[model samples]
Target: MNLILFTVVATIGYATAQSEQYTDRYDSLRIDDVLANKRLTAAYIKCMLEKGKCTAEGRELKSHITEALQNGCSKCTQKQLAGVKKVIKHLINKENAYWVELTDMYDPKKEYRHKYERELKSL
Candidate 1:
């Protein structure tokens, strides 16, 4: 990893700023189901990469990805954070290519990749 429109995590939550934190509309998404479905995962990946059409959730996610990654997702709700962590873990361990692609896109300067990597390893 630069910029991850495919912050896959972004697609999972896609929160909007309302009050002090991000909205919780997508907080109840089933991340496990998404991860287990290759087609769904591919769709998200394509969306993130700007190679395919985005679902509403994907569009929302893409909008906030840079801000979310740069700011450590400070606005995310707890459930969204948990889902993000899970998705990051999956990206790091199983989908390294996508992870790299996302990182390269979102963290082009390598600003947040190492930080996230260390954090994920610790978890």
Candidate 2:
């Protein structure tokens, strides 16, 4: 019984340590890399920018992109930038599921539909 209990406790401790390492890895990642990835970026933009008001973090992301565009970044590779651009295009484009999801969430607001359309175009 003691051995079984010890084994269970050790397993839990190992799992917690592994999860903490992943959390730390994620926390230290830069915003660009966070938003550049397909799954994270789309989910974040959908929830923060489309469904709800842009959070401070979201605004910071916009600022980051604008700054990068205005004065380029030596650290950012063209491939990384291109990937982000591609994902942004997917988000704002009329053909994607993201557009449909945002529109459905913004239902019953006539102006919101136009606003969503215009926002995508502006971006």
Candidate 3:
């Protein structure tokens, strides 16, 4: 009876570990999906920044990406990193352009808009 109980406990522990590993793998795959989709990546980051959901330091983004890569079933390659950078750059450019347009449409009397325009131009 003692041996049987030990075997059952060991089996359960192994299964639990396997389940957690699978979950991690799934999350990594999801991250890869996001990274692979340029439009999705741009939209996600832009929305996060615009909504103030993201920090200015970009630490969260970097950590999330690193974690995903670390837990990923397959390690990320240089090509993947380059692709992510391109997507981020594209999103930043788009956001800058949007700010510029908003600035152009703002009334000169609005000090806030004028300041925002200057900031966008600087970016």
Error of 1 at 48 (Å): 1.2
TM-score for model 1?
0.81
Could you tally the backbone clashes for each prediction?
12, 0, 0
Which tens-of-lDDT digit does each residue in 1-90 have in candidate 1?
224755755655654334657667777778999999989998998899898999887887788888899999997888878888888888
For model 3, state the Cα shift of residue 60 in Å.
Answer: 15
User: How many steric clashes does model 2 contain?
Assistant: 0
lDDT of 3 at 10: 100
| Residues forming the 10-long window of minimal summed lDDT in candidate 2 | 20-29
Off by over 4 Å in 2: 1-32, 45-90, 119-123
lDDT of 2 by residue, 1-123 (tens): 999999999999988765532112123336566546776666566554345455455554444443343343222445545544554455666336665554454343443455535644666
- TM-score versus the correct structure, for each prediction: 0.81, 0.31, 0.28
How does residue 21 of candidate 2 score in lDDT? 26
lDDT (Cα, 0-100) at 53 in candidate 3: 43
- Best-matching candidate per TM-score: 1
lDDT per residue as tens, model 3, 28-122: 22445765676665555554335324433233444444343334323334444444445434433555553433333332344444443343334
